[model samples]
Target: MPYNFDDEMIDEIREKNDIVDVISEYVDLTRTGSNYKGICPFHNEKTPSFMVSPNKQIFHCFGCGEGGNVITFIMKHLNMDFVDTLNLLASRVNIDIETKKTKRNKELEDRNKLLFNINKDSAKYFYENLQNNKKALSYIRERGIDESVIKSYGLGYALPDWSGLLEYLLHKGYKIKDIHSLGLIIQRKDKSGYFDRFRDRIIFPIINNRGSVVGFGGRIIEKNGQPKYLNSSDSPIFNKGYNLYGINILKKYARGKDVILVEGYMDVISLYKYGIRSSVASLGTSLTENQVKLIKRYGKDVYLCYDSDEAGKKATNRALEILKKEDVEAKVIVLKDAKDPDEFINKFGLERFYETMSNALPYMDFKIQLYKERHDLNISEGRIDFIKEIVTELKKIKSPVERDVYLDKISKETKVSKDSIKEELKYLPIRNYKDKYINKNNRDNNKDRIKPVINRLEPGYTIAEKNLLYLICKDKNIYESVKTQISPEDFITEEYKKIAERLYEYYENEEFLFKTFEKVLNDNLIGTLENIYNTQINIDASQKNKVLEDFIKTVKIKKLENKKVALKERLKEIDLMDSKSEGDVEKFKSICLQLINIDKELKLHQ
Candidate 1:
């Protein structure tokens, strides 16, 4: 059901949910002067560049240019839609939104409800089958899975019979097509009948963030099986790339802790049983950008606990690249003398696992170590090659202090001089180093040119427009007076013009809060608005009038200067003609008069 929320109801929701309070649930904000500061959740930064203004009810990240109000923050942070964010906020404020469901939406909702019911029943059937199947139960029990742990995780088993799930679903009054759509049963290719998807395997029901069973993953109990693990194919409700295996439980425990990303379900389940609850795994696939984004919603830091084998290291490297691209603070956990987390925890116990986690190497350090082992640092050529590769990796470090620290480490390990390493770092081009590691053939040709950092400063006219908007946003009286003088066209930048237009609309509706316009603004415009709001304009009540007057004058002067340039160009065209008509002469005369008037306006501003 979709709700048609009126402006007043939306405003009421915004009024009740304070931006600072809402953002505090995800970001750790500390008071810094008049604003709250934290590491920007949208990107990785050592410094606290993410600022939230309680007075203005808006947040701005000076690092990544992510800015918005409460609802906007939730939408970006949680990767949810506008209506979903509104409903979530409404729930927080104890407001029930009145929604009308169309026939199509109602049917979709009913179908989804049916799918959920089918998945739930299938999970129960598998669980009961687990208890009756001695071999499956013994295999699970031998792997250190207890009864309580099994129940908590909804661990189950599929009987060896092919028609086990098919017969059960039919008896439960679920259509075969519905069960097939849920990935519980597979339709026969010959169109003869349907068969169970999972048979003779231990089942792990995949639950979504909303606590609904959406799919399943099955693993063979016996060794040397053809396929070790089988997962449900992609369905309407389940996207393995977007959802983590144990995130439903990980979200609860990962509030203030770093999430441990493993490669298998047993790794997650075992770690959870060992009392390390902040663990999640991708569903039998490689790490993805969407999954990384999902992990970021819970915490900024992540620990990659994949297997320490050759393939595992490659997977870990790939995951590191994805996490780095997503601006997530990631570290790699290397387990010794064990195949995976399950075996490591079982062999070394939880204390040693904790120690290993505490001693996990930073991503750069891990990469350096891996490269050192790969290159023969015993010889001069090997050392030179290693140094070049390490310097390339070092250049990716954004913080000067962190880069220097690693430079010292590389110097100590390779017996190379720190000065020589620093010199090499200075010469290395600022290319995407992750691409070099991920794809050797995809290296950029223009690696000698340094990549420029994004500039946050707007142009002169843009600055004036933003200043004027800031004034209008801060004071309602200023909004009315400013609106009367300057129109949205006065803003030179298109983004600023859009913001000015929205501000006028909100002001017309008597909704003064900047948050009231968040739902209507895009991310870039929201960022612009936040930057404008966050900018400190040192003007008293008496001086505010003068400042607003000056800004308006500057905008008018810029507009007039643009008009003068166009008129002068037209005059040049008219002069270039061999024979000018009487109307052309009159037009040239009109342009000259307009240019003179524009000059006078510019002089007045000056």
Candidate 2:
């Protein structure tokens, strides 16, 4: 449960805690003009680029582009969430916040508590079953899982009887519907009775951060079981996507060390058994955005040790994409002779696995190797194709020297001249050779060649949109006048639109204050707002109204122009059709009418 803090309360908490004083606890700061400068704690930099403005009560790092108010600074520096950070700052100032929950929230919390209790009881029942069943105990012992380790994970077993768990839970005074809702049991087709979901399987209870059982995972013990592993379905308190197996235990020993992300429950268990405490597994699914974010909270550097098979390689690629998108640095551990971490450890022992982890490939190198496997390098065409594929990845590299190094490696491998590859990459922004020559038909067809995407100057409407948002945030009256004509939706840039949305919402309660308005934005969004704030707006008071009017008109006209472009493109698409249906004809008429109206609006705006 989280405490509810209103804007006024947030303001008070912020005011009591000075940005400089709060940040000084974590970073060493020196006075520089009106602002303070310090080496950025968020990223590695020798020269100081982190600045804190006491006047505005905000901090920004030019190197990493992380900027926010005092609360945000604590959230990033300490790796705490908004609520926890706020609560911490509140405690610092000795401000007591009353825990208030809405009726619906209270009901939900109560339900979650009941569900946790049921899961705990069910886990205990399974654990007791494991102790009595000699076959189950032997199976686990054969896997080299010790009794202490089993107790640490709360590992258990479910009897083969269909209603074994059902009978036990019923005997313990738990209702059948409540038990079935947790996915521990399944209802019969005729709705006559319910049976246990986990039967003759080794049960792995999924514990959350608080050490409460939220879900269960079962691995089949019988040889003939169809699905090898079965997990609890999503319920009120458990979402498989939102959690990782063994993360609760891993957190205690992580200590800012690199995390090992594996593919299976046993992979994590095996690593932990070998004193590798910083490994966690995705809950029988592809790595998710939430799971990546969770990994980021614990540590930034991650080692992805998925299986070595084709499906495993695909999953590794998918995980890399997510981790890259989230800005978390990741490397891939390539295991030899073994398919997964569990087998690798068992086959080659722990020290060899450690050596493999130490010799993990950088993501770019792994990607290059993966691409090499996709095409034959012996033939000239295959080499050309491989070079093209590698260039697409190389373009993402920000440094020219780094890009050139990879290009040199590709040149040596494919026997293609480095200068020729450089030329192809030089024109890559305008044309994708891979797209142009994906297949024989496409290469033969010249029209399939992509048009040059010239990097043009920013549109006038984009500038106008940003300037208007800046002015609106500076003055509430300007926001009131602008709201009647244009909205946050009219803004073209995503960051500008987000600022407008927050600004509009904040103005409803109170007038603009830099520190107070900053409360509305998340950590990622604060940098954009700060950059906008730093921009020089030099319009004289006499010319302010006229400038605002011009900006509004330009934005409105640009919107109409966008609509016109879309309708014209739709018309071209319709023309390409060999035959038009009645619905298509009607759609064309509607588009033409809309375009005519847009033209009229454009004329008025001009």
Candidate 3:
């Protein structure tokens, strides 16, 4: 049996959990007039466009058109299904839900829970092992990590002996196949038995945003080890690309401040220990787009604090491009005479590290300075090339004021005339000012303009459908009255038709809460519906009935017109045939009669 939640139970869970409190955990929202606003977690934008209404228990993003109630938000944000999201909320509010689970589902769920327990037990085993292992303990202490930091990060050590974790998990009643699936134990080559995956290493458990120990990162105690670090392979629950090392702990500290993005696990732990708690690191991988968006959910600003080596510089450049795509503000931290944050903080006191962070350069400034250093600007050719590059970068700046400021800076630096740079900018190719993350799909579509099939529907039809849906969402009476007069087929757009059908179902049940309807809608539909609901169509109370009537009439006329055009096209094909059968003639006559009837209907509506 599948888990089924009654409407009343869902309603009770939603009523107990406030939307503002739930959303605030993921989005940094601030009160804006009657509603709270924050950067949308769905899409990247600089200005705050995501709005949450406390009174309505709904949220809407004006920028990306994402809107929905509390359940919808959690489902989309965490990428969980309806039942899982409901269970999570129910647990939060201390409501016990009677879930119907099949034998297979129950087995899988039990296995997953056991995996979590195994990881927890493994972490504790490693922690106790660290207390006994003097070499690993001394190595961590030498790296400036204290006992408090060790306990806070759950630092541990794997014993030198093989089959340590294997024996422990097996003693705890975990099967070899299950432990192998978790990447904690490996099957022997000879098919004899299993052995521990981690041995003679310092262990750092990788926790997810939900505070679950999903994976682990290990550092070798001996200096002769070939690889300095080893991370858990991809498993059922953890993907290195999606999980950050310290984000579970960082979120609370990064609420209102910019996030400090470092490169390694030690850097994050060390920074957190030294009072800089808003820091996280990618787990043995390059910074990914998913990681950047994860950071965006916590804060708008990101400071790149990777190592100062050439590889680190390249990594920073790659990260900046991805962050720019998401419209996140990025800055580069260049430490003097230090390779990374750990060494910098260790070499100089915490105050010096804070000073360097405070004086971090904006991405563009850092890029320009890097370019200047690469080229010999003393020569005329080199100077001209530098100026052209600066102008190209300046064009990417969306704001005219910001562009002018950078242009003036370039003019002073290179002794180039501002007018000359401005003239060069005019001849350069036009660039789309929209955020690349949101505009990427549209850009791809534009490249396929030669495709024969295109959206040929009139804009007026879409407007009419949207307006009617908006009006219906605003007032339940409007929805109830309109559903009886017009079916969902009357709507031209598929999205609008879906919205209409869902709204009709809700009102038909006499359920007035919009949050109840949110359970059935996905993220995209929720955003679009929220967009429609939030749009203010100012019609006087006395004129709302007339406006709604006119909108319905417009949609009906558009539908009839579409049918007329389609019928005429079919008639043309019929006329072009060499020989017409009696059936074809009868079909033509039928179409003509239907067209006449549709014309009369349209006339009456008009």
Highest-TM-score candidate: 2
Q: Residues 1-606, candidate 2, lDDT per residue (tens digit)?
A: 223455566778899999999888777799999999999866557999999999988887756556668986786567666677778998998887654325544765686688788999999999999999999999999999999889989999999898988888889888887787677887775778888888889999998767889899889887762457777765556765568898888778885888999988899899999998889998765677778888877764899999898768867877887788788768999988998999999899998998998999887898889988989999988888888878877887888898888888888888889999988887776432222222234435765565555344345566677788777765455777799899888876788888888888887764365544665688788667755653334443333566688788877776777779889999999979999999999999999999999988876764
lDDT of 1 by residue, 87-174 (tens): 8999998886754225534665787799889999999999999888889899998998999889878999998798988898899898
| Candidate 1 residue-wise lDDT at 407 | 86
Judged by lDDT against the true structure, how good is candidate 2? 0.79
Model 2 misplacement above 4 A: 1-101, 429-606
TM-score of 2: 0.56
Across 278-389, the per-residue lDDT of candidate 3 in tens digits comes to 9999876556667787887876578999888765775676677677877887998888998889888878979999899889989789878877875778888888889877
Tell me the TM-score of each prediction against the true structure. Answer: 0.55, 0.56, 0.54
Better of 2 and 3 by TM-score: 2
Candidate numbers, best lDDT first, in rank order:
2, 1, 3
Q: How many backbone clashes does candidate 3 have?
A: 2
Which portions of model 1 miss their true places by more than 4 Å? Answer: 1-104, 430-606
Clashes of 1: 0
